[model samples]
Target: MKNKQLTFFLMAALFLIPMQVKAEQVNLYAAGSLRAALGDVAKAFEAEIGNQVATEFGPSGLLRQRIEQGEAAHVFASANMEHPQNLVGQGQKGPVALFTRNNLCALAQPGQTVTTATLLDVMLDPAVRVGTSTPKADPSGDYAFELFGKADQLKSGSTAILTAKALLLTGGPDSPKAPEGRNLYAWVMDEQKADVFLTYCTNAVLAKKELSGLQIISIAPELSVGADYGLLVLDGASQEAWRLALFILSPEGQKILGDYGFVVGGLPAKP
Candidate 1:
């Protein structure tokens, strides 16, 4: 009888030990471009750490604005360093880390006559409707305008011409929402919003997958702009949030980002 009671008590304590390791929840706000990749990363983290990750995806700039406005979040991943750096300037925390990289690309409608060499002329064509996200509200748009600035270096007055003619089609509060489970760039092209849209290469790849035959044209080096993604943990966040940040910079997480066509380079050695 004594032996049986001791065995039962040990079993009960063993079961209760697992319960004592209470799971934590990490709130994450990230750039819309990271939706697929980060979703996978979050799943992997949850499985490994037994913690819940609540994610919100949107334009990086707008997400930063929300965080600045007192919305509680554990981590923030921005498309460009500027937005996260802005938070650091405001005393968010230290050591804003670069997690991934992306490059500008042109997503052309099906059968559009465009290529790396001819991309400039095709975009310059007065009849071609060029689309861009809202500058300052999204880093993709800022990169698009930066590409335009490079174009000016190649051909005088190109910036004025491109910026003046470009259509702000997405990444704004007033922008039309894409259909459920539809890629915004693909849907915009399907709706005939523009003949050519300037966006991230990763976005172009996803758009092409969604809308078959949509062309993903690489920008020439002269006009190419690369985006640096930044990762930040807010001051006073749970340790689980920092763990999520480290997981994103881990080899597994970077592999997931690379598999999604993002340029994963220059990452710090994993600790």
Candidate 2:
């Protein structure tokens, strides 16, 4: 009876050990734009590797600021290559893979008919209310500003229209006072609150189903800019974090990113 009891206890221990191990969670920080695509990858990764991945999503610029301020995140994914490189330059060394590339797009609510021939056209149309993140805090916002600058140069007389557009798109209720809402572009897209918003191509792809009433229009002159998703393991990340980062930049990871409409590049581009 004693021998039988001991064996049963041993069996139970063995079962519980792996269960506990599987329950270990890795923390990942990603840009808000990557929420949909990463959700799929996280689900698949957990199933395949038997590990849990907890994700924090936000603007890449904000994530960089957090890391610089000594925030505790194991894996970091940035919306731009520059942020990851900045992290690496600051001595956080790891593989920086360009998991995706996104262009600027103007998204409008469903049934909102507007041909955005010029940035002025997009801004001036009283029927088209615009929204965007604060350029000072978010790269998307910065890009939006660049778009406006270019527009202002091309169409000088439309400054008031652009100013009005800025006011219209400036903030949501949850926006912070300083930087405002840099990542809320998707919320506007999802809720149909604003007629137009500037957001990433990947975001548009992910929301294509839910935002059936919205349309994505390309920005002319290409803005000569694109957002690249990059992954890095911080200086003192755990083994699990390293593994998660590795898995995210792997071919399997790139494939998942592609499925979400991200243009995955094998290596980070030269600035």
Candidate 3:
């Protein structure tokens, strides 16, 4: 009887030990723009590895500030290279990978017909409103500013006109939220706050998918700008964090980003 009882206890311990081990969770911080694609990737990774991924999504700069303030996060996925390189500069030794690229686009409000040729003109109309994310806090806004600068080159003083008329609506602490909807941009448009917004093509796609009657006006190549996304694992991160970072850098991960409308190829070589 004593031998049988000892064996039973040993068997129970084996079951409990692995369960406890699998309870470990990986914390990941990603740019708001990556939410849809990364969320799916995280789900797959968790199922395959038997671990949980807790994600925090926000503007790249805001997320960077959180990490710099010592907020508990293992991986940082940024909308641009600057924030991650800043982390590496501060002593986090990790290979910075350029994982994806996104281009600027104009998301027009419902029934607002516009083409690439007429994009700047439509936005410039005194009657039409324009929305943009906050500069410095969100790379999307910075990209918009660059496009505006290009417009200035096309027509002298156009940049100042656009800047003066533009509304800084997204990316900061006062960023707008979707009305219990899947697409955040749709809600902003529904509010009639702006007739159009300058953001990434990927984000515009997301908005179109979630809302009907939205038109995406491509930016002409001559005046177009693209954003490069960066990913890195901070020093002192858990083994799980490192694993996730590697998984995201893997080819399989690149496919996920591509499916979400990121330009998968033609990026700088991965580190």
Candidate 4:
């Protein structure tokens, strides 16, 4: 009888341990804009969960398109809120969770005469060249257009000039016709191309030295120019993925997001 009781206890413990362990894996796809920050978060999350968090980083819009195309991602963390909302609207995502926010800035090449105050001057300068990603392919690119449009309203023809200055892309690595990462600012950054490239605040955080020794110029706040990072569990993901999603949104989970430069917020309480 004693031996039988010990055997039963050991069997139950073995079953529960794996169950507890399996409850923590989260597979995630995130935007390239958040990559530098999220890497830290992913590490911390894994340490706590004793499970893995697999992440794929790319342009937000491209990541969203992949999810829509039936890629088996368990969670989607976008640099902008639109991708999550679009997924929700299409019935691909669940309840929306706004996790963080970010600001925008202009990137310029080294030795450039343009200051942020002088950014408009350069934008309007026929001698200087500007580049940006395409609106549809990149949210940053889209935000660039919107910001330029606002600039036009603030001044005159600012939109046209900014758009005109961009290199504009049509696809990312997944696109067969354009199987490459779209770095709108790549040429300018490498000294192979343009004089100015518009990029995000976090990009400034991660690539300050490489981005043409660029400094930000102030733009008006009302330019429809903010990014809200969001996360949502994917449909048809494994149970492990769903558990990981929950873990990321938990307080300990959200704390990790801060390390990655995400403006943290608690996940919405279950309805």
Candidate 5:
């Protein structure tokens, strides 16, 4: 009789386990630059749970606007902390968790002579056609603008000159097209539109993979800028949302992000 009772309890425990597993489908909004990295990470999450993680990707600010407009999303993964922190401040979300960091680089074709020790000197060059994303719409662009602001402090009037000369060429759908894993700046270079593109290091890495001879130039250390990618599970979201957030901060997720060229926990202070 005791043996029979043990078997029955074992069966009940097995049945109860599935009930604890979150089975609700989840919606995920993310920054476009995360495409290669997060795609695999989301698949890993899906493999662990039968629930689906439907994702939408775009410029981080635009994604933030969508979330603010009452768009239904269980979680948001952004290119920077400001958007996630904004939601947290509004009580629309929980505490922001930073997962990774990315630094800016200039993409140029081989022999383009694009690497200047200082980004200010590069942008300050009247002859160098520089390209940047639209500020306030993309975190990458915001980083670029921050660097420009720094340039202003360093040289008094450098910011105005850089901003005026920059070709605001990519980031959103409305921006001119290059290839999708695109360095529109490079595309412009290919077409002679611009000399160099200011973009995430990872994007420049991907661009180099597609087209050989694409050179990545470092942003001068003095004016270096970094992007902090943040994650948040919206308040009252399904349990799966938090699960995905935790999974992204897990070692496996960090590895995936590292593989894609992001600094796992932010870059070493620009030495």
Candidate 6:
């Protein structure tokens, strides 16, 4: 009887030890645009792996700066390849996988007459306010500027005109802060910060969802720019960090991103 009781106690202790060791903390820094989608993805990942994911979201460029300044992020998901690639150049040991893609769109307030066909004309109108994120601090801004460059090809001097007139509204250090749980683009438009805002299609979609009557107009193919999102796992990161990266590239992860309106082309096959 004594021997049997000792064996049962040992088994109970073993079970409790596995339970205590099962959950590890994963530090994830990701683009602000990915908040909704990644929030769900993190929940799913946690359920599957029994690991806790501590997430932080902000402009991809700003997040990259934080990581470079030694903020101790295990995984970094950027809205553009350039920022993560810059980390690779800094000896972060990366192949910098392209995890998702986004496209530029015009988020116009209600009553604005803008369409793919006449986006350039409306943006160039002197009375119209065109808002964009801060370039070098947000990939959305870079893509918007790229769109402006494309516009120049369609209409002479468009790049100079648009760039000069574009308002650095969001993603800047001094940009107006959105209220808690508010969509930045939606809040900006609601506040009449800009008559027309150039942002990601995903952002525009969420903004429109948050603020009814907002218009999401696709940029004409001739003047459109694609944003390539990159995922990187820094050197010396825990295995959980690498696991999270792979999970993001997995079919399940790709589906979540697709549902959020990101381009999931060239993703891995479902297993």
Rank by lDDT, highest first. Answer: 1, 6, 3, 5, 2, 4
- The CA lDDT of each predicted structure is 0.92, 0.70, 0.87, 0.69, 0.82, 0.91
TM-score of each: 0.91, 0.74, 0.88, 0.78, 0.84, 0.91
* Ranking 2 against 3 by TM-score, winner: 3
Two-way TM-score contest, 4 vs 6, winner: 6
Which regions of candidate 5 deviate over 4 angstroms?
1-22, 116-119, 177-191, 266-271
User: Could you tell me the lDDT of residue 213 within candidate 1?
Assistant: 85
Poorest stretch of ten by lDDT in candidate 4:
170-179
Model 3, position 99: C-alpha lDDT score = 80
lDDT of 5 by residue, 1-271 (tens): 9999999999999887856654788888998789779988999889986778898878888889888899998889999999989988887747888899999988875767655565567667788888888788889999988888888767989888887788888776588776665555446667766677888999888777767787888877778899999998998897778888888888778888999999995333445
Lowest summed-lDDT stretch of 10 residues in model 2? 170-179
Give the per-residue lDDT digits (tens) of candidate 2, residues 1-271: 9999999999988887845344568888888778778877888889888888989877777778888998888888887777888888888776687666777777777666655565457566776677776664466766666666666566675645665566334322245432243234445666556677776766665555554656877777634346656778887777877778777777777788877777775545558
Backbone clash pairs for candidate 1 read none
- What lDDT tens digits, residue by residue, belong to model 4 across residues 1-271? 9999999999988887845334445668987777756766677667775668878987888888888888878889887778888898997748877777876776666667765566777777887776665576667777777778888666787778767766653235433232254333443455545566666766654555444455555554555477777778877777766666676677766766665455677745668
Give the top-scoring candidate (lDDT): 1
By descending TM-score, how would the candidates be arranged?
6, 1, 3, 5, 4, 2
Model 1: worst 10 consecutive residues (lDDT sum): 15-24
In candidate 4, residue 158 scores what lDDT?
Answer: 77
Quick one: how many clashes does candidate 3 have?
0
How would you encode candidate 1's per-residue C-alpha lDDT over 1-271 as one tens digit per residue?
Answer: 9999999999998887856657889999999989889999999999998899999999999999999999998899999999999999998765799999999999998879989999988888999999999989899999999999889887888889999999999998788899999999999999999999999999999999989889999899899999999999999898999999999988888988999999886456778
Higher-lDDT candidate of 3 and 5? 3
Task: Name the candidate, 1 or 4, with the larger TM-score value.
Answer: 1
Superposition TM-score, candidate 1 onto the true structure: 0.91
